[model samples]
Every structure is written in structure tokens, then in C-alpha cells.
Target: MILTTKSQFQSLIFTGTNGEYIAHYSHWSLRSVFQPIFGHNNILVGLEALVRIEDVHGESIRPDLFFSSTDISIKDKVNIDKLSRVIHIRNFAISEYKNLKLFLNILPSVSEYFALSDINTCLLSNRLKELQIDRSQIVMEIVELNANNEYLFVEAIKRLSQAGYCIAIDDFGACASTIERVKSIQPDIIKLDRGLLLEHFSGESNRLLEGIKMARALGAQIIVEGIETKEHLQAMETLDLDMFQGFYLATPQPILSCISNAV
Candidate 1:
């Protein structure tokens, strides 16, 4: 990716649209939407990058539908994943909240593929260098890490950690986001899935406290997502959690739009 001139860089399928950089693939346009990650002090500490997909008619498409659709092949899924990051990186570089941490997701298949390859995180590293973003400011979140090859997955996490990028295990308490995997990864942060919060509120389990304790004792920050109510925010604060995110704090919106208005 050695670039001698701006022309070469501009040829990456990103179109300049009304002060924003968007990636185009097939008949759909990919976008980066940010959900605020708030700290204990109720300050903006980071943003979780979420994807938005739209068809040629500009009609909104569910990300889950676009991402999990069997209508698309595995190769295109990986390409869309990469392009999602590209659009996010380019957009974040031009946003006002560039100083805060930008949490980018690593697709499960891509993570597994990268782990076995020599270019593990070179693409991300090169992109950040090209954009002049500090490696520490990027959070490499591995989704569905439980599905990846265990040995190579840990190796990939180690490689990224050694490269100065903070690692996070997304969706704790769901699927196979178990303690064994947590111990194996030992990520810098562990994001609790929203279901855990629901169970806690319903008094069905005390796993929430256990999760917080687990993350704390492991020397990792705990972030609880899906805090939609005032009680939700208060309860998290009472636990002295490290970070929080959900509709109560702010909804997911495009980074370019967030700068003009308070999120």
C-alpha cells in the first residue's frame, strides 16, 4: 500500500459525499455509525463502530441481515467487513472525536483467516499509519471469537496486543463468550452483552456482578452495552463499572452527524 500520490489513494472505491467518505460495493453503500461509550465519570471515552448498509434506492437495510445473509458468499462477506473498516477509518479521521478511542470490529471469519496468515494485522496497522492515527487509540474488537481456531486466535490477539492496539472481547455472556475463552484471550476490555443486564434486572441471576468482578480481577475494563433506561445507567454507576453504552447515553448515528450536534 505504498502511496506516492493522492490519486492512487483516491481510487479505493470511497466516494466523497457531502463532506463524508463512503465505501461502495455491489449495489449497496457501507457506512460507519458510532455509539457512544461512556466512562464512569459520564464522559465520552470511546465509540463502538457499527455498520449501516443501504441499497441503491438509499433504503436502510438491517446490518444483521446484510452481514448474516446467506444470499451473499463468504468472500463478499469478508470484503464487506474490510470495506466497513475502511469507511470507518476514513470517516473517523475527519471527525471531531478522533481523539477518543475508535472501537473497530474484526469479523470472526476474517480474524481466523488473519490468524493463520502472515499478514495478521498488517492491513489495520498500515491503514492507521496512513491516517496518522495512534495505534493505542484503536480498539480491535473480536466478535464471535469463540468460533475461531483457539490456538491461532490467541496468537492473533497476542500479535495485536504486542502491536500496541487495545483488544476487547465483544458480547460476553452470549453464545460461547465464556470464562475459559476470557482467560485464553485476557483482553484489555470485555463487553457484556445486553442479555446479562436483562437477567440481572429480572433478578434471575447475579452473573452481572460476577462478570464485573471477573473483568476487574483480570485487570480489564468492563463495558456494559444496551443501557436503555435511567435505572440502567444508575445501576451500572452503582457497580462502579468502567464504561457504559446504549440508548440512554446516545443512539448510534453517523460520525459526521454527531460532530455538529451533541450526542
Candidate 2:
């Protein structure tokens, strides 16, 4: 008897009828939730697409767990990343908030694949066009997890930036190598890790302030994540941070027709 759980089933890589290795998540019931990024005066400047997956039983599965449970090979990981981007763009196109910029997370490894050739560039551009999304409206947020190949990662970011996609270094301060990454990639935006806010109450603002200054010096806009409380908002009010996203301002949800439906 083959005992298969949903996580296990979703992790299995199989050869499709077309003789290509298909990522399990590509066929899974996946949807995207948009989290609004606010600028000064609480104006909505952009929306970040957060992916959600549902099990066969209709239960919500956390994305982190979904990805971590799957021992996906590098190739399949790249394929899954591409599929997720397509889904996000498709959903954004059909939604009423198509006017705002859409932020999409891309794994550094997957980005390297995109940097490999002009064909890949055209492929993504065509995909966005098919969904009526402009390439310029997409902000590629490169996730730094296991981004060991600095040379490849930097080159990939350069290629993508040249192709007109705004590059952002996601989860800054989450690791020590982030500073070097910021210097090398020179991303258009730097998102401070949510962990920094946890330390704000302890009166440790030096590091956070320094990070903001460094990003500004590099000609990058600063965005702070995880602002869930009024105190958190107060703590960040004096900073030069350009954008904010978290539970306090708004939470991730499907963009409904009316403004009152926002989370």
C-alpha cells in the first residue's frame, strides 16, 4: 500500500506526458493574496503578491511549510518559481488593482536561470504581456535564502534590472551577507527584516538606522516590514523609510470589488 499525505503528494516530481519534469505545485490549487505597501500618509504605492496553497480537503497550507516539505531539485524549484510568477501576474491582471505596481518574490537560484539568455527574458516579457501586465510594473523581489553564488546572483540581478524590472533585495539584515549583496546588486529597494522591529522596544535603533542610511547611500528606497502595532508605527515614524507593510496597516487578502472588503 502506498501511503501518501498531501504534502508528500505535492512534493513528488513526475515526468509529464510531454516528457518534461513537472513541478507538483504547478498543478496544485494555488492562489495569490495581495498585501498592500503603504507610503507616506498611508497611500497605497504597491501590492506584494503572496502565494497561498490549499490541500485537497480545502484546508489552507502555509507557504513556508509547503516549500520546506518538498525536497525539490534546483530545476524543479526554478520551474515552480516561474509558475508562481505567472499565476500572480494573471491574478493581478484580472483584478481591479491593476494600476499599482505588483511585487513578486523570485528565488535567487531561479533568477539565475532567467539571466541565462535573451530567450528567457522574452519568455517572461511575453508571459506578462499575455496577462496584460507591463514588465515595468513588476518589481522582482529576490529572496536571499541559499543564494550562495554571489557572482551568478549579482549578474542575474543586473540582467533583470536592465530588462526594466525593478530589483529589490528582500529580507535585508536577515543575514550577514546582505550588505555585500546590496553593494553588488544595487537594488532599487531594500526591505528591512521584520525581526528589527522586535528589537525596537529594547531601544536598539542604531543598526536599523544605519541600514536605512546605507540603502539610501546606495540609491535604494527603504521599506520596513512587520509593523504590527501602533508602537511599531511610532518607532518607525521618525525614520527615512519610504514604505511599510504588515498587519497594522493591512493584511494579505484577495482584492475584492469594494474598498470595504480590504483586510
Candidate 3:
């Protein structure tokens, strides 16, 4: 294992096959945020990006401490850069395992996606081809959607779909246009938000169920997020969700290690 024991929590930077860096931190005291989900039977699966901080005594820090910040610009830039690098890394890892799919988190603003000109695309595509990764398995998870520009979002989604890239509406059930955008864009994947699962009372269950059914009918797959327990997993099963992600499974780890272990 390339992991090192240092402070209470140790952070290791994993270099992607594409030369990007992903910093992974884990603490031995608890379930660190850097866990990767396994499909069916521990066959290395998707990873959830998470953060863990340590104190002087090496105890793992609480999640709230890290997320309570109010800096908008810093948050946005970090998200944009992180997603781009992760995708490049995944592209490199896929050379060895052609069946693996890469799920990348995307910001809502289309402008946030790094603009790829013809030249950029050519270079990147060449790199991916060398790694044996097809454009189809790369799924981009758009973090949020609203009713503001249903038509425009749908158009953007269609263009991406036409290019063989899969479109996923992340945090689906948290916004007003959940139904409208799903109907319009027809995303390949619809990810349920943790808020919906946490805040829903008796009255909201039926509506959530309807949303999932509507998405499925429109030819989109359903993936529930924020699952933290067996109860959440069982509830998702009751709802007939196709896939799920959250603490119940595993958190995101360095892509390099996940790839190495898969072999």
C-alpha cells in the first residue's frame, strides 16, 4: 500500500494516469471519507469525493467544520478543477479495464466546464484512445438544475448526448424543475438528492416515488445518493432504484489506488 501513517489523518496525493493529482486523506479512528463503493461483491466501483481533517491528537475531524465556509468563488473554482482532473485520471485508468465507467461531478453552469476547442479535443481524444477508453462511459453529473432555462439546459444536454457522453442530473429532487428538466433533457441518469431522502415526511414519499417512475419511463436510469445505512439501502430497493451512493457503501478514495486494487 502506498498509504503512509503520519498525523491522526494522513493525506496522500494520487497521481492519475493522465498526470493530474487527487489528494486523498484518511484517519484510522473512524470511517474516513475516502471510501470507494463496490458493485455487488467488492469489484471496485464508483468513488464519492469527501474531506477529512485531523486534530493535534490525530482524531478525525467532523464533516461540518470543513463545509461551514461561505466562500463562493473558492468553492466554484475548486469544483471545476477537481472534476476536470478526475475525468482525465479516469481516462488513464480505463486503459486497463475497459468496462469501468467514470462518474464526474459537474457544476450547473455549462460555462464552468472547461471549454475544449477542436485542438483540445483532438489531443485529449488521442490520449483517451491510447488508453482504450471510449467516450460513452464518461458520465458527467450536473450538480443542480432549476426551472430557469429548461430549454437551454435540454439543448446543452442533447448536444452532449450526441457526442456520446452520458448526461446525469445530480441532486435531482432538490430543485423545482426536477420533473420538467427530466422530461425535457431526458438524461441518462437521475441522481436523487440527500435532502429529499432526509427531509421527506409521510406526505412526500408518493411524490418522490412518482418522480423516480417518471424518470424511468423516460428511459433514464435512477441512482439514489446520500445513503448512510441499511435502512436507506432497503428504502431505495423498495423504490426500485438501479444504483446508490453514500456512506452506506464507501466514500471516494484516490483513483490510482482504486484502480490498482481492481487488478
Query: How close is every model to the real structure, measured as TM-score?
Result: 0.89, 0.83, 0.64
**Clash numbers, per candidate:** 0, 0, 2
lDDT of 3: 0.54
- In angstroms, the error of model 1 at 180 is 2.5
Better of 2 and 3 by lDDT: 2
Backbone clashes (count) for model 3: 2
Q: Which candidate ranks first by lDDT, i.e. highest? A: 1
Can you rank all candidates by TM-score, best first?
A: 1, 2, 3
**Per-residue alpha-carbon lDDT of candidate 3 for residues 1-263, written as tens digits (9 for 90 to 100):** 21112331113445535453434433212221233444444355554434344444777655333323354344433433343434444433634433666665544444223332231354334545666667676676666634224455556567667777777887887654377767767789887778767754334676567768788788888777787888877777766667777766764544444535532
lDDT of 1 by residue, 101-161 (tens): 9999886666665565554346667778888999999998877534546777778777778
Cα lDDT tens digits, model 2, 98-191, are: 8888999988766766556673345567667767777788899977575647677778789888888898888888853378878888899999
Worst 10 residues of 2 by lDDT: 1-10
Clashing pairs in 1: none
Cα RMSD for candidates in order: 3.3, 7.1, 8.6
- Give candidate 2's TM-score: 0.83
